[model samples]
Every structure is written in C-alpha cells, then in structure tokens.
Target: MRSDLSRRRFLGGALALGATATLAACGYQEDTGGSGTSQAWSYTDDRGRKLGGDRPKRIVAQVTAAAALWEFGIRPVGIFGPSKLPNGEKDPLAGPIDLGKVQSLGNVWGEFNYDRYVSLEPDLLISVMYLRDELWYVPAEQAEAVEKAAPTLGVDLAGVSMPDGIEKFRTLAKALGADVNTPRINEAKATFERAGQNFADAAKTVNGKTALLVSATKEGMWAGNAQGFPSSKQMAEAGLTFLEPKAPGDGNYWEQLSWENAGKYRSDIILLDNRHGNLQSEQLKASYPTWRQLPAVRAGNVFAWNPETPFYYEAATEQLDRLGSSLRTV
Candidate 1:
C-alpha cells in the first residue's frame, strides 16, 4: 500500500504540477512569486469551492491533515480515523481526538458519517492522507457527502511524497490560519531546499549508478519497477540512475522481484521499505545480516525507506521539509 501510494504521487505529478503549479508553488519562493495576496491561502475542495474566513475556528480534518493542524495550533473537531492519531492524541489536541467524544467518521477505506458531521457543525471539513494514499482510503463519495453536510474542504493529499507534501502542508496551514507567508515559512523552505540540494549532490557524486526501492513482507516481497513508488522516482530525481523494470502501462506498476533477481540488478543502493508481515518483518533484520553477503548492505549503502512527512494532511509540506532533514542525516 505504501509503495503504491508513492507511485501515485509520481504519476500524478505530471498533471498536478502543471495544473496547480500556481497553488502548489506557494511557500516555495520569495515574494510569493507574483501570485500576490489575491492568491492567498484557501481550501480548494474536490468540487472546486474556495473556502476561507477571517479566522477559521471550527474545523473537521482528515487524519493526516489533522496532524498538520496540531503542528500549527489548529485543533480539529473531528478526523477520519482514530488510529491516524499520533501518540499523545488522547491527552490533548496534540494528537487524535477522544474516540468516545469524537465520532468515527470512517475507516481508512470507507465513507464518513454525513449526519454525524452535520451534528458536529464544523466550520470547515478537511481531508488528510498521511495514513493511506489511495482515494479509496476514504471513499470519494464521502468527500462529496461531507461537502453536502457543510463547507467540506478536501485536500486530496493522496500520493503526495516528501518535499512536495511539505509544500502542500504549508498551503493547508495558511488556509487554516497559520502565518504561512511569514519569515517562519521562509526559514522552513530554506531548510528543505538545502536538504534537496544535498541529496542531489550526493546522488551526483555516486554518478550514473542505479538504485532500487523494495519492500519485504510476511506475504512476500514487492519491488518497484518504473512507474512505481515515488521513492524510486525521488532517487532518480535526486540524480541517481535507476534500472527501471518494464512495467506495463499504468497497470500494476509493481512486480515481484525474487531476491536472486534483485541481486542481479547491480544497484548501487538498496532502499528497503519495511512493512508489517511475517516475512517482511523478519527480512527487516535478517534478510541481509552478513556484511560480505550483500555488497550494498556490506558497504553500508542500504537505506531504510523513511517517511518524511505525515503522509495524510495539509502540513504534509512540513513533513516533506522534514524528509530533507531526515535523509540528510541518513
């Protein structure tokens, strides 16, 4: 599921970057790059409604976006899933809302309760995706349903990876009343930009070498071919070469790569995307234990796939910013 999510972001980037560059480009440049205050923060829902007020007080956020809100002092009245909350959610607005008091809008792949949402009487309804990437993570119909109940603000953050996700988060923050256009935003942007540059520089030093992003699970193993996970795309974007597998058109971008075949790829780096499963969990520590057994792991070139952002919200941009910092440390 995580692999598919990244793939979606890369594939969608072609369209999203073009169609909403004006919006997406926010907090990414000095002077707002001529977008101006007219292009100020606002929620662009699935239905294309623009939602903003002088001060947005009541909010209903999706799980990931809800986390972003916590980062910026905006407490959501409700969220999509209970498990989406961070560790301290129960104690305060720092995490997920109280399950008993807050209604379970829906699961990661289900519909939200429209009637209950209306009862909650939120000023704005938000959609966040840090947990799941697929649109089905929360039924598309639910977005529309919530819109009907109130001023639903659906930030379709599905498949938004790393730095891009962080940019999206800043935009969401501004819409929710954070001073995203302030010097703080600029500092954050500078930090993230430097991180990307460092990643790019490192990739260049390893010039012309290829890398692979794969995950091991109890079920088995999954490897990204071309048109797959954004992690692979990210490495490629950072300037490292990739021996992309021939994935059939937009179908399943991922295909199984046996460990034997995996070694044959001759990748300079191996990014292991650990997951929950017997085989994958075991593989996490046991798959490549011996130093001389595998070259990349032996050379300390193997990297664990680290999630940079909250995968599911407006503050995803902040998460992306963190990605650069995290990857730099790695």
Candidate 2:
C-alpha cells in the first residue's frame, strides 16, 4: 500500500498514461500467429523502440504483464512484483497464472532479485510502463543490470485509456506468438465490449451521482484524478461522473488533503482504493472521525477501486461488471 508509496512512481505532471484466461507456459513454443521465420524475434514496445532476440522462448515479466499475456496464451518463464498475497495465496490480479511453475524473482517493492533473474536464463523481460520511461516493478537501481541480462520490453499503461492499454498488451502477446483470436480470448473480448455498454447504461440510470475515488489515511485522503488513470478515465468518459480533484500536487495522479481539509471534495458515492496497506472503508469510517464525516461514507456509498494494471480484458470485464452493478444499486 502507501507504505511503499515511493515505489509507486505513478503519473506525475502530465500523467502517464483483463479477463481470466489460462495462459499456461508450454515451454517456449512456435509462434503460429507471429514471427515470420528466421527464428529472430523482435517487439516494438510503447516506447516505440525495438527489443528483439531469437524469437524469445524464455521470458520473465511483471505480474500484471504476465496476467495479460497469459490470457492471450503467451506464458512467461518467471514473474516478479506482487505475484502472491501476504497469506501466500496468489494475488487475484495474477488471474489464472499458476505461480507454482513460474519462478518469482521478487514479491515486494524494491526487491528485485538480480541473481535469481540471471539464474532463470531469461531471453526477454516484459513489464508495463506507468510513466513514459518507468517500468512498473523493475527497480531503478537494477534497471541497468536487468537490461543487460535480457532485452526488456516496456508497454506504457498511462496517458492512455483502458481499452488502449488492453490493446497494447494484445499487441505484445501477438508478437510473442499468442493467438489472441482464439475462441476463448475472443469470447472474453466480447464480454468486455458488452461490459463497457453495461457500465454506460448504469451511468445513465444513476445520472447525477458523483463518485469520488480515494485512498484514506489517518493524516488525510489522497483523491484520485480520473484522467490520469486508464480504467477511471474510460469509465468517466462512459458517463460515470467522478469528482475531478484540482491541484494534483507533485503526484499528478492524486490530490493530497489533510484530515481537516478532507471535505474539499464531496461525492454521492466513494470508490475507496482497495489495495493493501490502506485501511478498509468500513474500518476507516469506524475509526477516523474525519472519515466518518464524508457524505459518501456516512451514506454508506463506498466501493472498492484498484488501478487494474497490465491490461487484461477478462479482468476489465469483471471490474466493469462490479462497478456497473454497484452504481445501479446506489
């Protein structure tokens, strides 16, 4: 959670910029849908630069990036980042990726295991970029070391809408030889399309209700900026009117407020950041006097919100279904 806020390195200034499907690692297979031959593999990431190799068979990726590719059928040999829960259960964001088979280089912030990474004999490394040049979980100090070990591919998840983010991953998966057009993947995509409309329809039904997205703390609250986040940006554009926070400070994605000033933004509903580390909504409402005063909290209109990174269609569909169902209720 916020304890490692420094590692968040989220959208600053201009702001940067799925589904569950089984992505089983079948041991670096052939790319029927990609790689025109010669055994040489190359992928041009969001940065518009080429990261190529001998049609990379052994790949390692950030957890979320693995989630996206897994659905499309491109399995990584290893993964890093928040790959599992504190309780040792796999993070749901991991989707259906079986962590038992994939080597985990690190499971927390600032914990990239360089030696273990080299031990895997990785051919390519993949991760999503939150800021233009910042790879989500690759520690800055180890960037050079990691890059030297294997060609790293970074896909930008910021400064773009959710659909764009999802498509970018699909593109990457295709380059890696995943047949995204498969029946299962196509069904998931179709479900996502329907989910988008479902949310739009729900937004219309709850026409004027304003939803405020936030992360609460004893000190105060950090309000989310819709435009700076892909999922929220797509939702906002679809008619889920979110309270737009002014003056986004150094963290271009959030507006920090003290407990005394928490009332600056009022909403008919609140989307609480449900990521680990933050006090849950009910807990905050019961313990923090300032939190209890918020109109949405007192009205019991709080719902969970997560950034939803790496870009998968199935996960996006699930998130949309939950948000739409919640909005229609409140």
Candidate 3:
C-alpha cells in the first residue's frame, strides 16, 4: 500500500486552473508581421489554449511527447520522465531519440531539476494530459515555473479517441516543421493501420475470450477501467472483450481489489502493467497463491503492457501487433 500511496501522491493532483487562466489571459505574441524571413508557428492545444510564437528550435518535452516529436524530426533539447529501465536500458517509449544527445532533467515522476530545465532555454514544453483529472505530466507544484519558462502544450491523450490523439500529435509536428509526407512517415502510418486490422481480426477469432488489464502491487491488484483508458477503449473498439469491474474505484481508472479476491473476474488473457518496476503478471502469479489460481495465469496467457506508451504511429503499431499476436494465441 505504501508504493501505491506514494504513486498516487506523485501522479495525483488538482489542475491549477487559476494558473492556466492567468496564462491564457496574458495572450501570446502572434507574428502578424507575416515576415517571410522567419517562420512562425501556432497551435491550439487540447485544453483549447492558443499558443503562438516563433518556431521552436529548443523544446522541452515529456518522454512520450519527445518520442512522438522525434519521429517527426523535431528533437527536444530536454526530456523528463522514466527514461531508463531498472537495468539502465533505454525505455521503449524513448526509443526514437538518441538519449545521449538530450538532457535528462529527471528520470522519475515528481523529480524535476529547475536549474537544468531553465538552462535549456526551451521555447515550448509538451506533455500528455488525462482529461478526467485535467492533470498533465507536469506536477502541480512545478506548473507555475514550467509555464513561466515556456508556452506549455498538452496532448489530450485520454479525452479523445486514440487515432484522434495520434493525429493531433501529427498536426503539432507539422506546425513545427516536420515533413509529414515523407515516405518513412507514410510507411509508419500505413503499418499502424494494418496492425489495427490485424488486431481486429485476431480479436474476432477469439470470440468469447476475455482479457483483463491489471496492475499488481504488494497491497492489492487494480483492474483497468476500459472506458477510462484510451488504449483499453481502443482495444474494445477493435473487438477485444475486456471485463469491466462491477465497482470502478476512484477516478474510473482502476478498481482496487485485494489479492485474496483477485479471481473475482475470470479472464482468458491478462495484460500486466509492465511500466518500470511493476511486477510481471507471471511474477505476481508466482508470489500470490490466489493470483496463481486465476485461469489466465494457470494457462500462461499473460502479456506486458505500458499504459503510458507513446502514441506515435510506429510505437502504436508495434504495441497493437503484440496484443494481436497475444490474442490470436491465447
């Protein structure tokens, strides 16, 4: 419970709408002169805040945002989040960027180096937002300083459909001078579309088989709310049948269930949270007798999942393909 409580403390917070309002009222400088010499960029973020200024060359972004931008040829000068694995391996979410070239301000949640962030002189800051909570990756305590440093933009990952979210990132990248029509970029998009089809076909084959997405901590197990998580919603749309908890807990993201009652929902396949330190579903089964009794665990049908995975086409395609394969076999 200590770990879960600490995670909630680090990731949970009320939006500083007052700060957002103040920043919005200040108004951004629009390059109306139409100077042909220097290109100007403007974008309306998910929060409906208009952000306009000279094209940003030095950007600071959350790990997933940075990865999306990297695919579009816009590299951030600094990135923050869990960028490395327990074995010091680069996180898959950060796969598009050369970590050696970027400044790592902080690698864990709630850890930010003000001095290093300021030194980067970023023109823009980007992160993902969970619409229900209106909280972005940036912590509430650091919001003011971070906003002061540069115009902040949030990709509304949870508010819209997954495809729409990906398109928004593409639009932002295009505004930032990305060549969206490049052969490589187009190939990635096509690949993603094919992966989506594959996933749907796989799910269709499964028919009545059900999947459960859950995260296990020492205190208990939490089931993912299909309606709350964009990825889970996408899977459901693609034909995957996810069991919804009878009683969704706080925020509609998860249902807290004690380990003893972990078998409450019988699932043919289990998607285990694989972010950084969370135990793999197999490991959980090995540790908890009750968890071992689950049909999915007993049948060895568990797959890893990263709830905060990058929304870029390439990453999304890979993840979907993995799930599709898992479904086809399970």
Against the reference, the lDDT scores of all candidates come to 0.49, 0.76, 0.76
- Poorest 10 consecutive residues by lDDT, candidate 3: 1-10
Give the residue spans of candidate 1 off by over 4 A.
2-43, 46-56, 81-108, 111-119, 128-136, 140-144, 156-161, 182-185, 225-234, 248-253, 258-266, 275-295, 298-300, 311-330
Give candidate 1's error at residue 111 in angstroms: 7.6
lDDT of 2 by residue, 1-330 (tens): 232353354743221210011111211332346655544556666665455445778999998889888888888889998877788887766886888889998887778889999999988888877666677778777776776676667777766888888888888888888788999888888999999999999999879889988987666788878888888898998998888888775447778888888899989888888776667887887777878888988787888888654378877888889988998888
Clashes of each: 25, 12, 0
- Descending-TM-score candidate ranking: 3, 2, 1
Residue-wise C-alpha lDDT for candidate 1, range 184-256, written one tens digit per residue: 5566556656656666766656675556656554333455553244444455676766666554223344455
**Can you give the TM-score per candidate against the true fold?**
0.62, 0.88, 0.89
The 10 consecutive residues of candidate 1 with the worst lDDT sum are 9-18
- Largest TM-score belongs to which candidate? 3
Ranking 1 against 2 by lDDT, winner:
2
TM-score of 1: 0.62
